[model samples]
Target: MRARAGGIAALVLGAVIWSAAPVSAAPAEGVQRTTIGAAERATALRFWTDARLRSARDLDAPPAASTPPAASAAGGRQAAPGTGEEVRVAPLPAPGAAAAAPALAASDPTPWTGGGLISTTAGKVFFQNAGGGTFACSATVANADNKSLVLTAGHCVVDAGTGEVYRNWVFIPGYANGDRPHGTFTASSLFHLDQYVATAGNANYDLAFARLAPLDGRSLGDTVGAQGIAFNAATGREVHSFGYGGSAAEGNGERLNHCSGVEYPDAGREGSTMWGIDCVQTGGSSGGAFLADFDAGSGGGYLVGDISVSAGSSEYHPVLGNEALDLYRQAGAA
Candidate 1:
């Protein structure tokens, strides 16, 4: 589904151009938070009130023995319960899973096998349009209120250098260097977290979600549709990936799509957002959406995860979990 109010595609576009230079900390003409979540809302008077707030270290850990068993990525690969292995964010999508599949009447697109690569999202906190600059990145149309929503890394939206956010941001789908086929959408909202925004030393969970206004004359999901979001599951038999690497190999256009070999699970990559699977990509590929689809079958593609903030390797994710879901939900709510 396309972002209802102009969602993920815009985020992917912004991230591609982000980090060119630092954006200002201060909000522009309409960058401030006109709306905030329950947590941020309650902070209005809490700072001056009598009770003190707790820091990250102050929170107690859930009892190790009381935690539920975590499913593994491997169909049969087993680990003892509560073993330090990292668990996936949520249960895999199926009829029983809370996650729902997209009503795709169209045959899915095959794994990108073209000569060039597809774009993905790579965000920078202080992104700006100082040079009329445009960045091309990949994004999936995911179901959110039956509308489109873009997903990317938190640092892409929030300023990494300072806690400042970007302003006058827009998403240019299929924006290759300067080739903008889908045109652009003004960003209405950017969703992230205080932890990533601060770039804390041990920050691991670095997901982000953003919203954008609809295109001038068309609707998103109605026109472009969207991919299904996968959660926790052991059913990943094989997956396909895409990206627009700045290498001479990717050629010079956005329409050209380059793809990777079949993806296999890397045990060490578990839990870290920067997880990597062997793939042929480099710097410009960060934030590209990792899609799930059948390369040789009738129904071909759906976006289940995204390329996390790592270079030279692949770390994609299907959006899920309580904490992460809450954060993303709050992003749309805000």
Candidate 2:
């Protein structure tokens, strides 16, 4: 898997749900964490001023290299997309809808208006890369007992090449054209699957959870509300994916962009079972949220996945499984 924006490649692996058994060898290794001290948080806030954000709007990069339309591997010989394997009834009911989603004119897929929770829950993530330069990605606020959890792609938090997690992480919900309507929320810590930290190439575990620090004495959920997250969720859904990434169709990551499509299994690898959508979201959209039965009002829905990697401009995300559940539970507890 690779981020088209950065042109970075990572090793991807077949999907396998790891059990919740303790790793006795490393008792507390299931979830990896890194703290952002006060000094760093203060620096991050000033680093993302209005001017810097506006400059980023024009910085969307090129799409990642494209994969062969089809390739050979092992397990199911790449099931043809839309074989109904991607469509399944959600294991549990999705969150209640507040207002209907934006309506398209049938013939048009353009014109993506930031709607519902999509407006407040989904936002741009900024971090300092290992190179000391700034980069952006998409992310979403997720419901948690602590009211401080955020969901995003693993690579957005950790740089696979240097094996170092990026620093100065901050989330700005409803961010548009360098505007922070809800102000900025810096990350207290970041966590991801041990598998991703170890393999660095396994797209199967590319999702991550971030714990945000309180700003103005309020948790992230207290301000924007959070979306219900489902693990071991049913597949084959008609999903609406959101991101703030550079795209010719999307005003180059200045405004949020999204597309609706059915999820399908990976066509290039055997047993890789990663979920994919037919979208053209570019770099900054890497960590955006994928919502099932999204609502325009309330901004609440079942968070099934996030933008992880791209096959050309099309996007792929790790499906929520047992491993994801464990990560969520541990991150929320923290």
Predicted structure with the largest lDDT when compared to the true one: 2
Q: Candidate 1 overall Cα lDDT vs. reference?
A: 0.37
Worst 10 residues of 2 by lDDT: 18-27
Give per-residue lDDT, candidate 1, residue 258.
39
Please, what are the lDDT tens digits per residue for candidate 2 over residues 83-199? Answer: 222322221212342443654421112545635666777888887654446677889888888888889988777654344676667999878877788889998778877666554
Candidate 1, residues 1-334, lDDT tens digits: the string is 1111112222222233434332332133212232223342233223322121111011110111111123232333322212122233221121111222222221122224321112222111112322333233344444455253666554344444345454444444444444444545445566555434332311243445656556655544344444444443233445555544443545422332334344554344333332234454433343456655522332224444554433223333323334445554554454
List CA RMSD, all candidates: 15.0, 7.8
Best by TM-score: 2
Shift in Å, residue 240, candidate 1: 2.0
**Which lDDT values do the candidates have, in the order given?**
0.37, 0.66
Q: Model 2 segments beyond 4 Å from truth?
A: 1-27, 56-111, 296-299
Give the deviation of candidate 2 from the true structure as CA RMSD: 7.8
